[model samples]
Target: MSITPTPRILVLGASGLIGRFVTDDLRQRGCDVVGVARRFSGGQRVSPDDLELPVMAMEASALAELIRARDIGVIVNCLGVLQDGPGSDTGAVHRDFVVRLLSAIRQSRRDVRLIHISIPGNETHDRTAFSTTKREAERLIAASGNPHAILRPGFVIAPSAYGGSAMIRALAALPFELPEKERARPLQPVAVEDIATTIAWLAARPLDDETTKAVTWDIMQPEPVTLGDVIDRFRVAFGTAPQPRITLPKLLLDAGALAGDLISRLGWMSPMRSTAVAELRRGVSGDPQGWISATGIVPKRMSEVVGARGASIQDKWFARLYLVKALMIASLVLFWLVSGFIALVISFPATTAILTSRGWPEAFAVPFAAITSMMDMSIGVLIAFRCTAATGLVAGILLSVGYMAGCAILTPDLWREPLGALVKTGPAIVLMLVALLTLDNR
Candidate 1:
């Protein structure tokens, strides 16, 4: 299927992770692409010097305006969300959004073709927040009686999203040690480009064919890989240490689910509910036979995409590996710097007080005097916070405490109380925290 260079296109949610790439793909392919976003249109206004594309930065109401104004032939509802944010509800994300967008499209004179990207198992209770809401949106689309193509994509785990976030990147880096029972279930992971390619291919197909086409397609890499196996490959690909992957029993999982809910309420990342836990544990068995028999679009495996580039996003995993290494190094450097600051803050002031009170500058005092004594005992208040919060608070403490300790060491007998100082240490505290909140540290 070949599309002309200038098929007037309108892409909603163009600023998002996938939408940005999809728009870039269409524009590069010579499709007259216009991005509809909340911000200014993304690329250069379609010009000789610039890729000169038009991006409409407007709310949904404004998008309705673009539909009427541009005579847009196709409307790609690329809007979706993940991660933590004020407006990140998956239910409202699509349920309301799809209802509004579809209505607008139907009302428009342009026989607008719609390409909606959906994740697989969207209707399953075991499905995560994204899957559940997206599933609902799909049902609404079917009822819309409008021409539409719904694509159920697998784990995109792109470098951009995966690299910037903690959980996804950590998942890719760590090797799984799942219990034998848990490992029985399977997951067929796909690369990010597979998504871009899927869209490009679908974009080229006639809307008539696409509309009467399959309601859902299993979009993934040709070869299916298990969750545990990918971790091993990730170790070799990134040259990182094997991570601990433990599978908890129902009893432990139930306890964790409760804890996760409580923490999320306090604005901490919560663990999955029992339903979600079951979905992850069970996953999907066998190849999604229905998906393949429908679209006939085979996805590229991670192995194929290791060095491949898609639209605007690079095989950023390669670069992302570097990013991870850099961040780890940077975090270590900040840790030490803060430790030094802590010593300055606590030790220096306490030493001065001791010296004035004792009227003694013990010659060997610096090494003998400990700085931890000068640290305010109150810093431990951070222990009550969730993992992310705890790390930030503890990081601040290390810097402040280390500075105090360093200063106090200069004059030992007066400021340093070895017995009192022995209780608090920057390194020891950080390590203890790393052990306590395994989710937050990485």
Candidate 2:
């Protein structure tokens, strides 16, 4: 009896939500998986504390050489960007990267099978960057002579949410009624595990068959559910009562999209951008016959999928606490920035008066106030970034302790204020500590 050798598979975007699962799935099937990403730090090849696959962390220019050196037989392209944010170019990622990758594969002269993950609908007229670029990439893959399989999945639901999935989870967790227009859109949410399993299955399948090449499959759930119905199901899973349905006018949604675009321009990845809104409004349901026929795995209904993976107490708390963390960080940032502005610009008189009342010299007070304001602003900026969060937390703790000590020596009576503003510092310090501990090492 002859034993088939394990195929060497290269998974792009291995750190991503879908990529991680796919990498794990392939590895579990005893395939030799090499995960590739645009960037990896501290001599890290694979994702820290996630997967054990060997990884190549380099630029696109080095991809061909790496593939040839590693003898990768199958390339699973899971790389995708849903939104244009800081350092994220949607067109470049979706279109340019795929073009470069395909060219490299051809140039390397390796018989590599390409499995590309894409969206279902190919609306040529769609102005959304996501749809336009994805379609372009698909066209490139089809044109490339290399054997390839394109899987267009609808709404992919995972254990955790990120990007549009995160927004969907957030909306479902909301206590208020959803906008009527959004409720009308239909979606067939597919489980991430199912998608991963399918990818693994495809990778192991023989690619010598000519008919399977350049084929595209619309991967989705068996039944389509309204957007509103999906949210209601999530609400039930999260142990929340279904809120009353309300229709939001098109005008309001449009206005919100406009505002969201402005926010995105400021570098915040807002889900309400016009492109995202348009995509959501267009709906996400696709024929699943191809997927079922290809893999012989019937996709589960959204209800069954959600029910099996129902939100636990920990999940609910995490969902709610995520919002609380955001609000707390925002509040802290605002408080520090505003306080700095008051001391540095608006209320210098009051600040000087307070310092003078404490018997500080005029020369010392001015520089002292300026330095304090700058330090406050610095702390706020530091806390805003994940990389500098630990530093910021430590600085914040020291600063808070110093301030409390100074207040005890000087304005001790301020602690007795009815607002309990001074008392709140203890909780604020604790919150910062909590955030620091939970910070992502990525």
Candidate 3:
């Protein structure tokens, strides 16, 4: 009796929300899984132990070499980028990277099966950057002559939040009324675990001649629900009271998108971008019968999954704390920027007078005030970014302590003011610490 060899699989973007789940699921099923990413940081949402394979660089040559060395039989590309960031191009990730990877695979002469996770609307005439790039990549894969299964999923609901999922959870948790336009937007939320399981199942199946002809499947839940309905379901799951809906003018949404675009230019991820809003306007959903027929796995309803998961106290805490963390970070940014602006432009005379009153020379006072203001603004900018937030928090703590001590010795009376200017540092320091604790590379 001869034993069939286990298929060696390589999973790209293994640190992301869906990738992490897919990698972990495949590993648990006793498959040899190799996970690759741009970088492997300890601070990713997924714990280090969950990743079976040590994360490697996403370079084409390196990845190809690894595949050859491992004798990989399947390639599951969980890689995707929702928005572009510094040094990370959306077009490159969605289209160019895949092209290079396919070329590398062909050079290796390995008849590896390709499983790609894509979004819906890519097949239509949608001209959005996200949809267009995805469609281009799909076209490249189809023409590559590799055995591929392209799965287009709707809104993937995971326990952890990022990008649009995070935005949905945050908005749902709001105690006030929500925009009516958002309430009417339709969505078919699919569980991340189900998607992961589906990918793992596909990886295990043999690639027959007929199956190798580049098939596409729309993977989503059978039941379709509106955006507002999902929000209410999440609120109930999180042990929160559902708020009433308020119909706001479309102009407000446009203005919000404009603000979101401005923020995106500053290298921050904003969910209210015009493109994102347009995607929401055009519902996210698809037929699930094809996926079911192929995999024989029926996706669970959104409400049932959330209800079961939300029974845990920890889940509720996470749901609530996610928004709290955002608010805390926002507060720190506002405080530091406002304080810096006042010192640099509005309160320069008052600042100089105070410094000179403490027996400091006029020349030193002017330069010191200017330098301090700049430093304050720098801290605000640093804290606003994910990569530099930790450093910013540390700088903020040191500066806060130094300023408090200096104020005590130089201008002790300010501590007793009605507004408690010096006393406010107590809360500010605590807020910075909270923000630091919640910082992640995502």
Per-model TM values vs. the true structure: 0.61, 0.88, 0.89
Error of 1 at 303 (Å): 3.9
Off by over 4 Å in 1: 1-3, 6-10, 13-17, 32-60, 69-71, 81-86, 122-130, 161-172, 210-215, 222-225, 239-260, 266-278, 285-296, 306-442
lDDT of 3 by residue, 255-352 (tens): 87787676666566666777777788887878888888877898988876776545466555555566577578777877888899899999999989
Candidate 3 lDDT for residue 422: 85
TM-score of candidate 2 to 2 decimals: 0.88
Q: Write down the lDDT of every candidate, Cα atoms only.
A: 0.55, 0.75, 0.76
**Candidate 2: stretches off by over 4 Å:** 1-3, 39-61, 242-272, 383-394, 410-420, 434-442
What are the RMSDs of all candidates, in order? 8.6, 3.5, 3.1
Candidate 3 residue 317 C-alpha distance from true site, Å: 4.1
Better of 2 and 3 by lDDT: 3
The order of the candidates by lDDT, greatest first, is 3, 2, 1
User: What alpha-carbon RMSD in Å does predicted model 3 have with respect to the real structure?
Assistant: 3.1
lDDT of 1 by residue, 29-105 (tens): 77777775554333323333222223222345655666888767777777775433343466666677787777677
Instruction: Give residue 49's lDDT in candidate 1 (0 to 100).
Output: 20
Off by over 4 Å in 3: 1-3, 41-60, 241-249, 309-313, 321-327
